[model samples]
Target: MTLTTSGPSSSSAPVAEEDGRRVRRRRHSRYLLAPFVFTVGTAVLFGLFFLWPGVLGLSYSLTDFRGWGDLEFVGLANYLELFQDSEFYQSLGRTFVYAVFSVPVGYVLALAMAVALTSKGARGKTPARIIFFMPWLVSPIIAGVIWRWMFGESFGFVNYIIQLLGGEAVPWASNADLSLFVAVLASAWGGAAFNMLLFIAAISNVPQSYYEAAELDGANGWERFWYITLPSIAPTSVLVILLSSLGSMKEFAMIQALNGGGPGTQNRLVVQYIYETGFERSLVGYAAAASMVLLVILMVIAIIQLRISKRNNAW
Candidate 1:
C-alpha cells in the first residue's frame, strides 16, 4: 500500500509541474502581446504616412505629374532638367553657404552660452538662461519679421543707429551678401538657445572630480574646460553640429519671410526653390526630383555625423 501511494504521488508531482509550465507559457504570451500590438500599429502608421508618400514622391520624380491631371512618364527628364537648371544650382550653392556659416556660428555661440551659464561664479544663471532661451520659443516667422524690421535697408533701426554714429547706412536688404549674412546671424541666434540647453545637460553630467583634479594640478578655467569638459561632451557637440547643419540646410520659412528670397532671388535656398518650382510654378515632378536630391544630401550628412559620433564614443 505504501509503494502504491508513493507512485501516485510522483505521477501527481509531474502533472503539477506540467500545469505550472503551461501557466507560465500563457503568462509570457500575455506579456508579449502589448509590445507586439504597439509595434504593428507603429509599422502600419509609418507605412501609411511616410513610406507611401516617399514611394509616391519617387514615382512622381520619374514622371511629369503637375500636382493634378494625368501622370506622364518622362523617364528621368525631371532629374536631367534639375541637373541643368541654373536656378537650382544657385539655390543649392546658397544653401550650402548658409549651412556652413550658420552651423558653426550657432555651435560656438551655444557652447559659449552653456559654459557661461554653468560657470561656478556665474550670476543670475536662471534669468540669463531664460533670456537666452526665449529666442528659441519665438516663431520663426515672427523672428524673421523682427529682424527684417531692424535690418531694413531704408529707415531701419540699424541704419538709424548707423546714421547717428556718423556711419553710412548698410544695405541689408538690397545686397545679397548682406542679406545672407543677416539670415545666418538670425539662424544662429534662434538656434543657439536649444543647443545651449543640450550643452547644459551634457555639461552637468560631467563628473565634478575631473575639474577638481585639474584645478589641483594648477589648471586654469580655460585649460580645464579645454582638456576635460570639451572631451567629455564630444558626443553632445557632434549631435548639436549635426542638428544645426541639417536645420540650416533645410531652412525656408524664416528666410522667406525675412527677405522673400529677395535681392532678386539671390539668397533663395534649395527649399525655397523647390517650393516655388512645385507649388508656385506647378512643376511638381521637377520639384520632386530636387527634393530627392536634397534628401540624399541630408542622408549623407547624417550618416557621416553618426559615424563620427560612433568613433567618438569608441574613443
Candidate 2:
C-alpha cells in the first residue's frame, strides 16, 4: 500500500482523460464536417436562386419599374389598379373555370386508368400503361399542337369524320366556347397519365386483405372500389386534385399553342394575361402585381386543401 506511492500521479490520470476527450471531440467534428458543408451550400444556393428572386419580384411590384430605369415606388397603386382591372378579372374567372373543369376530368380519367391497370382481370398491362403514359411524356406545347390539328375546323380529323357522317363541323377555332372546350379536353388528356401513375402507386400500397374481406362479404366490384379502394387512396386523390388544380390555373403553354388565347382573347387565362402585360405591353410592375395576386390565390388554395386533408386524417 505504502509502495503504491509512485504508481502514477493523480494529475497524470486527469491529463490523459482530457487528451482522450479532445481526440473524441475532433473525431465528432470530422464526422459532422461533410454534412455541415453540404447543408450550408444548399442553403446558400437556395437563397441566391429562389429567395432572392422572390424578394426582388415583390420589390418590383411596389415600384413603377417597367423593366427599365428609375424605379419609382408607387405604393399600392399597382395593386389598386389590378383590383379594378376588368381584363384581369375576366382572365382570373377563366382560369377558375378551367381549373374547375380540368381538375375533375383529369382526376376521373386518371383514377379510371389506374384502377383498370391494377385490376386482376386486366391484360397487356405493360403496353396499356405505356400508351396511357405517352401523353405525359409529350411536351404540353406539342400536345396542344396535336390536339389543334385533330380538332381543326377545316382539315381536322374530327371534322372530317363529322362531314363524312353528314354533321356540321364544330367551330373549334372560331368559337370561343368550343376552343375552350377543346383546351380543357387536351389538358385532361395530357395530365391524366401523370396522375394515373400516382394513383397506381397508392392503389398498390392498399392492403389486399381489405379487398379480400370485402369480397367475402359479397361486395360487388363497384362497392369494393367505392368503399375500400377510394377511402384507402384518399390521400393520393387529394394530392392529385391539388396538383391538377394548380397546373390548370397556371396553364399557359398548351393553351397558348393550341388557341393563342384566341377567338378574341375569350380563352385567355391569368398566366397568359400576365405574360402579355409584362412582356408584350411592357407593364412589368402591373404584371408583377397580378402575379402576386395569383400567388396569394394559389397559397390560399394550398392552405385550404392541406387543412382539409389534416382534418380528414384526424377523423
Candidate 3:
C-alpha cells in the first residue's frame, strides 16, 4: 500500500491508497452487478414466452377460459371432456404410435449417417449435409406438398416408379396401415438430416485418443463402440431421440397434406384432432386442454431423458 507524496511535511498517501482500494472494490462490484441484472432480465424474457404460456395453458385447462374474458370457473371440465372424446383418444393413440415408430428410426439413421460422413472426413460432407439437411430447411408445408406428390395414390412418384418396374402401385397415404407406416417413414426421411447435423457435430468433437487406444488394444468394432463411440455420443443420442419424439408429436403439415388424417381418421394424430376442435369447431378451450396434455407428456419425457442422462453421465 506504498504511495509517495510530494506535499511538504504532509502526505495523504495512506488515504490515497485506501481510496484506490475502495475504487477497485467498487469497479469489481460494478462488474458483478451487470451479470446479475442480465440474468434477471433473461429470466423474465424466458418466463414471458415459455413459462407464461404453460401457466396460461394450465389455467385454461382447469377453467373455461379460451383467451376470452370472464375466465369462467370450471374445474377439470375440459380434461373430462377430453376423456369422452373418441377422436381425441384415437388421435392420441396414433400420436404415441407415431412417436414410437419415428423416435428410434430417425435418431438411429441420423447417427449412422453422421458417423459415416465423418468417418473418412468425407470430402462430400458439405454436399451430404446440404442434401440431407435440405428437407429440414424446406418449409414444412412445402415438404408436405412435395411428399404428397411423391406418394400420391395414382400419379405419385412412388406408384409411378413401381409401375416402371412392373410392380403394383401402392397407395402410400391411403390405406390405414400403409398411411401410418408411410407417415412414420416420411418423418424418418424428413427428420434424419436435422439429427445428423447435431449428431455429427457432437461426435466430431470426441477425442480420438479413445479410439486409438481401443485399436491398440485389439478391440473389435463392436467392443470399441461399446467402450468408446457410444459412450462419446450417448448424450447427443438422447437429445436426438427427445427432439424427434417431440417433433413427431407436433407434426401437422405433412400429415394434413398427405391424407388429411384419413382413410377416415386412420392416421389422424392428436395434434390434428386439436386443430379440428379449435379452429374447425371453435372449441378453443378443449383444444388448449388437449395441447396442455401433450405438453405434459413431452415434459415428462424430457425430465426422464435428463435424469437418465445425468445419472449415466455417459458423455
lDDT of each: 0.94, 0.94, 0.83
Our tally of clashes for model 2 stands at 0
Runs in model 1 with CA error above 4 Å? 1-30
Identify the superior model by TM-score, candidate 2 or candidate 3. Answer: 2
Candidate 3 pairs with clashing backbones = none
lDDT of 1 by residue, 118-179 (tens): 99899999999999999999999998999999999887899999999999999999999999
Model 3: per-residue Cα lDDT over 1-315, one tens digit each: 999768833567778888999999999999999999999999999999989998877776777655556777688889988989888888999889889988888877888888778875568777877887788777766777787888888879989989999999896766888887877777888889888989888878989898889899999777976788887888888888878878888999888977788889888898899888878886677888999988888889889988998889943
* Candidate 2, 224-257: lDDT as tens digits: 9999999999999999999998899999999999
TM-score of 3: 0.84
Error of 3 at 300 (Å): 2.2
In every candidate, how many clashes are there?
Answer: 0, 0, 0
The 10-residue segment of model 2 with minimum total lDDT is 1-10
Compared with the true structure, the alpha-carbon lDDT of candidate 1 equals 0.94
After the best TM-score superposition of candidate 2, give how far the Cα of residue 18 lies from its true spot, in angstroms.
16
Residue 268 of model 1: what lDDT?
Answer: 94
lDDT, residue 258, model 1:
93
Per-residue lDDT, model 2, residue 154, is 93
TM-score of candidate 2 on Cα atoms, chains taken together: 0.89
